[model samples]
Target: MGREIYFGQQELTLKLTGITRFFAIRRKVTMPYSTIKEVLVSDFEAPKWMIRAPGTSIAPLNIYEGSFNYGDEWYFLSFERKEPVVIITLEGHSKYRYVVFAMDNPTKTAAEIRRHLHEVV
Candidate 1:
């Protein structure tokens, strides 16, 4: 299944659906727009060395969903294919330093998030 991104009045939400929700062990993640540091759309490959603290990963299929820990940084990833994705960097976030997910329109998604970030500022 795919993921959904929602922009709220003061926060951005990433909602994981279907089997993704089960594998990710999270239904949704919310962060205040003020916490967004950067947003970009790019091709991403999950580091093979990263540890999955509580998430699902299928390396062969490039399916990764849930929380991952690399060094001291925490990341929330949700992607089924190795395509372009929206990577959002955050500051003052309690759990994740990065939130990377696939969207139907990555460029548009990133732009929308950026607009929200600017508005919050």
Candidate 2:
């Protein structure tokens, strides 16, 4: 429904399943641990003027999925509601500078990501 986050030996993965994959126009995004700069859980609001180059957005329902661009920065977002989501800030990434997504347990997810990052470093 939302997305699944997986921690691999050298990378972290975000997999969009079911209808989310269709809306996102993407199945999965993988980034090496070195690229992950920070992870946080917060009530993030998608910018009002973001350009959806190849994504789906339903403003009334607050559903946003796929790639977005704003102020010359690339963002990959997959969230269905106005709630707390995990925001992963990345550096040295080829494409996305930020990956924002909603999860069933955003706090736990963020903690796990932090643990993984610590282990990788």
Per-candidate TM equals 0.94, 0.96
Candidate number of the best lDDT? 2
Give candidate 2 misplaced runs (Cα > 4 Å): none
- lDDT per residue (tens digit) for residues 9-118 in model 2: 89999999999999999999998899999999999888999999799999889999999999989999999999999999999999999999998899999999998788
User: How do the residues 20-119 of candidate 1 rate in per-residue lDDT, one tens digit apiece?
Assistant: 8999999999988878889999998888899998999999999889999998899999999989999999999989999999988999989988887787
Q: Output the lDDT of residue 107, model 2.
A: 96
What is the Å distance of residue 37 in model 2 from its true position?
0.7
Residue 46, model 2: Cα distance from true site in angstroms: 0.9
Quick one: RMSD of model 2?
Answer: 0.9
